[model samples]
Target: MLRIWKWYERCLSIHPVKTQVVSSGVLWGIGDVGAQCITYSTARKRLQCKDAEQECKIDWKRAAVTSLFGFGFVGPVGHYWYEGLDRFIKLKFQLRPKTVKFVAAKVAMDGILFSPFDLFLFFSYMGLSTGKSVPQVKEDVKRDFLPALILEGGIWPIVQIVNFRYIPVRYQLLYVNIFCLLDSAFLSWIEQQNDAPWKRRLGGGQGRW
Candidate 1:
């Protein structure tokens, strides 16, 4: 782990944007694998799968698609977004990094702006990438977006607090990408849930996976 991180740091020094993009893609892909396992486990329990079917079969194609979101969108966009946001807050508001006001402003702006955009993009991208129609993707977003945003909203602000308070601008996105491993799995799980009962409760419709 230490050696890998050292190598990553070296790569980051040489090509920061490229490194973040590749790392985000790889981590999101791994997270999708985790999501598949979790989804399969839930199905196995619900269906009482036989011993022969105990092991989960990973869908590599699906994983690749999910990784592309990280590579094409999250990595590049997040890199600039964080860099720009930090600069804007510093220059616009004249808040020092790690100050209470600075952290609060960042948290507020991030939650209000970036969080919703990220969730919206994830659902829309995943839906369209998997061949869903525009209307279908819109419906998927309507069903899943709010629940995800509301749930994630509670947690990420706290995480960003620590991140903005301590980590440097260059390292902040790396810190975020680490947490995105779990976040990607969560978003994948939510996508796979389809019209689960809880989702129905939140989304105000009757549907099933």
Candidate 2:
């Protein structure tokens, strides 16, 4: 663990963006694994109760796409966004600005911009990765985006309050990445909901597989 952190520190010193992206990908993959474990366990119990014959499998492609989105979107967005937020707060106030108003503004901005956008990206990426059409992806986005955003709002405000108030600017994205591991798991569960459009579409198209 010490050696790993040392190496990560080295990477951060040399190549912060790449390090963050790789870290985000690995963590997101772990999140998907966590999600899969919970889901497979539930499925396993149901199968046992029904005495049904089936194989529970991991969807590697979905996991890969989750990682891809984290690497491509989350790392970059959070890094730049948090940095900008920090700089803007200090510059806009021209004072040491760790006040309640500043933190609240940061949280609000994050909720406004990040929550809905990230949900849309997740749904769209998942849809396309699973071979859905553009229209299908749009429909899925329309169906899932609002509920996910609402959930995101409920969760991320407190999370970001802590993030903005305590974490340093350089490490804010790191803090977010750590938190997103569980957030990704929650999102994975949400995607599997009975009424989730992507799930329904997958069910409809299972005949092809």
Best by lDDT: 1
At residue 178, candidate 2 shows an lDDT of: 91
* lDDT (tens digit, per residue) of candidate 1 on 10-117: 998999999989989999999999999999988988887586367788999999999999999889999999999999999999998899999999999999999999
**Model 1 Cα shift for residue 140 (angstroms):** 0.8
* lDDT over C-alpha atoms for residue 165 of model 2: 85
Model 1 misplaced regions, further than 4 Å: 49-54, 204-209
- TM-score top scorer: 1
Q: Give the poorly placed runs of model 2, Cα more than 4 Å off.
A: 46-55, 93-95, 194-209
Q: What would the TM-scores of all predictions be?
A: 0.93, 0.84
**On a 0 to 100 scale, what is the lDDT of residue 77 in model 1?**
92
Error of 1 at 35 (Å): 0.4
Q: Alpha-carbon error at 162 in model 2, in Å?
A: 0.9
